[model samples]
Every structure is written in C-alpha cells, then in structure tokens.
Target: MPRYKLTIEYDGTPYAGWQRQAGLPSVQGVVETAIARFCSAEVTITTAGRTDAGVHASAQTVHVDLERDWPADKVRDALNAHLSQAGEAVSVLTAERVAQDFDARFSALRRHYLYRILNRRSPAALDARRVWWVPRPLDAEKMHEAAQRLIGYHDFTTFRATQCQAKSPLRSLDVLDVTRHGEMIEIRASARSFLHNQIRSFAGSLAEVGFGRWTADDLQAALEARDRARCGMVAPPYGLYLIGVDYA
Candidate 1:
C-alpha cells in the first residue's frame, strides 16, 4: 500500500462537521466519496484536525492509503473534479506521497485557528456566513490583553465544552493574539490541541472585554475560576477557521 498526504480547503457552511455521519454531509464523507469514485475502493483517510460544523479550514491535512500508488497530481485533480461536479465547496489544494509511518493526526506539531468579527454598525454585505457581525465597537487592544492571560499551560475547564471528550483540561496554548483590520477584528489561536470549543469560548469571553463589559483582570479571574458556568459565551462557528497545521 502507498500513502499520500493531501492538503484540503473547504467552506464549512454546508456540512455537519469534518467527521462523517451516517446520513449527514461532512468533509471527510465527501472526500472519501470522491476517492472511491476515483479508484473504486472503500478508502479511509486520517485527518490532522476535525473542525466543527460551520468552521472553515484553509489548510486542513489528511492522509490516505491506497492499494496502488497513483500520481499525486492525478489524485488531487480527480478528487477535486468529483467534488466540483458534486457542487461541494471543497478543494484538494495539494497531494503528495509520504512515508508509510506518517500519521496525520499523531504527527501534527501545531494547529492554528482564526476567528473573524465584522465590527461595525453596518452588517456584513458579502461575508455573512464567514464572519461574526458585531455592531458594537470592539476594543481589540482589550481583547489582546485579555488573550495574553490564557497563554501557557492551564486547566481550561471554563472554556472546554461540557460534551468534550478530552480526558483532561490541561493544555498549553502557544499563541492567542487579537488584532484588527479596518472593520474586522481577527483572533488567532495556535496550540498543539485544544479542548472542544475552547477558541470560541475564548472569543466570546474576550468579546465581553472588547465591549467594555469585562476587563483583563476579569478574564483572568474567569480562567482561575475554572467553572463552565462562568464562561461568557461561545462564539458562532461561522466566524471560526482552521487556518493551518504544522508538522515536523
């Protein structure tokens, strides 16, 4: 068997999430279907990270094993052709052969996420499904200050989703930066792994700070409290994007 690594990008607005459900559409399901169409085999792919419903990905990584090795470009173009024919908002950005020992998920070194907020009284004219619209003025500086408190290892129970299956809440966050670009407020988070909904949780809480409802000290206190009930809010999934993944 030969293994190939693929980089994928998708508009996550139409699927239930990255994982395949029996009847629901998913990124994984569509890609697998496209692969079967290309090679007529029931193939499975290992994903580096799985985004939730409505969460987009710009550089998602996955690897699949095929019984026979095909040209990498053919695999990319063929699957993309099938996906396009099906009207799926997904694309195979690139595909290449990799060592058999490479495991997409386990071999990941970092994962990056970006959340966008359309900040202004005027609503999103074109990017309605890709950004969160906030009429209230947001102080990006406050959000950034609050975000810094979340760096390093901590028990992120306040931000972790109740339904999250992660065994522990302890994780190290490498970067959490808040910035603004004209009418957009961008929040970027990078980590080895995140508790489910953690970034959204942070965004919601940080929004409070940005809106002047909370301060940096308040955000820090919420972190120390480690209580889910104390969590401010979970930002909408549409505003979230899996920006990239890194591997050694």
Candidate 2:
C-alpha cells in the first residue's frame, strides 16, 4: 500500500463536522468517498483534528493508504473533482506521498487554531458563519494579559469540556495570543494536542476578561481550581478555525 498525506481547506458551515456521521454530511466522509472513487479501494482517512460542526479549517491534514500508486497531483486533482461535484465548500489543497510510518494524527507535533470575533453593533452578513459577532467592544489587551496566565504546563480541567475524552487534563500550552485588527478580534492558540472543545472554552473565558467580567487573576484562579465549572463560557463554534499543523 502507498501512503499519502493530504492538506485540506474547507468552509465547514454546511457539514456536520470533520468526522463522518451516520446521515449528516461530514468532511471525512466526503474526502473518503473521493479517495475511493480514484483509488478503487475502501480507504480510511485519519485527520490531525476532528473539528466540530461549523468550525472551519484553513490547513487541515489527513493521511490515507491507497491500494495502488498514483501521482501526487493526480490524487489531488481527482479528489478535488469529486469534492467539487459534491459541493463547493470542501477542497483538497494538496496531496503527496509520505513515509509509511507517518500517521496524520499521531505524527503531528503542534496544531495552531485561530478564533475570529467581529466586534461591532452590526450583525455579520458576508462572513456570518465564519466569525463570532459581539456587539459590545472588547478590550483585547486585557484578554491577552489573561491568556498569558494559561501558558506553560498546567491542569486544564477548567477549560476542558465535560464531554472531553482526553485521558488526562494535563497539557502544555505553547502560545495564546489575543489581538485586534479594527473590528476583528483574532485569537491565536497552539499546542501539541487539544482536548475536545478546549479552545472554545479558553476563548469564551478570555472574552469575559475582554468584556471586564473577568480579570487575569480570575483566570489564574480558575486554572488552579481545576474544575470545569470555574471556566467562563464555551464560545460559539462559528469563530474557530484550524489554521496550521506542524509535524515532526
């Protein structure tokens, strides 16, 4: 079997999520179907992250094992063709052969996520599904200060979702930054791996700090509490984007 890695981008508004569901359309199902069409085999694709519904990806990665060898560009073009027939939102940006030992999920060294917030009185129209809209102005500097407290290794139980399946609550957060560009608030976060809904939880809590409801010390206390209830809120899914992935 030949192993291939795929880099993908998609507007996830119309799909149920990255993982395939029984009846709901998903990113995985669409790509797998495309691979099957080209490779003439039942291929199982493994992804770097299983993003939730309404979450977007600018650079999602996946790996598949094909029964026969095919040129990288051919595979990319073929998958895009099938995806185009299926819908316009999903695309296989690139594909290439990789080592047989390369597992998309496990081989990943770091994953970067960006959460976008449109801060203004007006409701979002052109990119409604791509960002979270907050009518009230946010203090991005305060949010950044609060986020710094979350850096380094710690028990992230407060930020982890109740339904999170990670075996342990301990994880190292490499970066957490908050910045504003006009009406757009951008949050950049990176870690080796994230628990389910962890980023959203972090963003929500920080947004509270940005709105003057929480402070940097409060965020520290929440982490020290190591309780999910101590967290601020779980931000909306529309704002989240899987922006980058680094492999070792």
* lDDT digits (tens) for residues 9-115 of candidate 2: 99999999999999999989989988888877888899999999999999999999988888999999999998898765888888999999999999999999999
Candidate 2 has a TM-score of 0.98
- Could you tell me the TM-score of candidate 1? 0.99
Model 2 scores worst on lDDT over the 10 consecutive residues at 85-94
State the lDDT at 179 in candidate 2: 96
Q: Give each model's clash number.
A: 0, 0
Per residue, candidate 1 scores C-alpha lDDT tens digits across 1-248 of 99999999999999999999999999999999999999999999999988899999999999999988899999999999999999999999999999998989999999999999999998897999899999999999989988999999999999999999999999999999999999999999999999999999999999999999998999999999999999998999999999888988
- What would the TM-scores of all predictions be? 0.99, 0.98
Model 2 misplaced regions, further than 4 Å: none
Q: In model 1, which runs have C-alpha deviations exceeding 4 angstroms? A: none
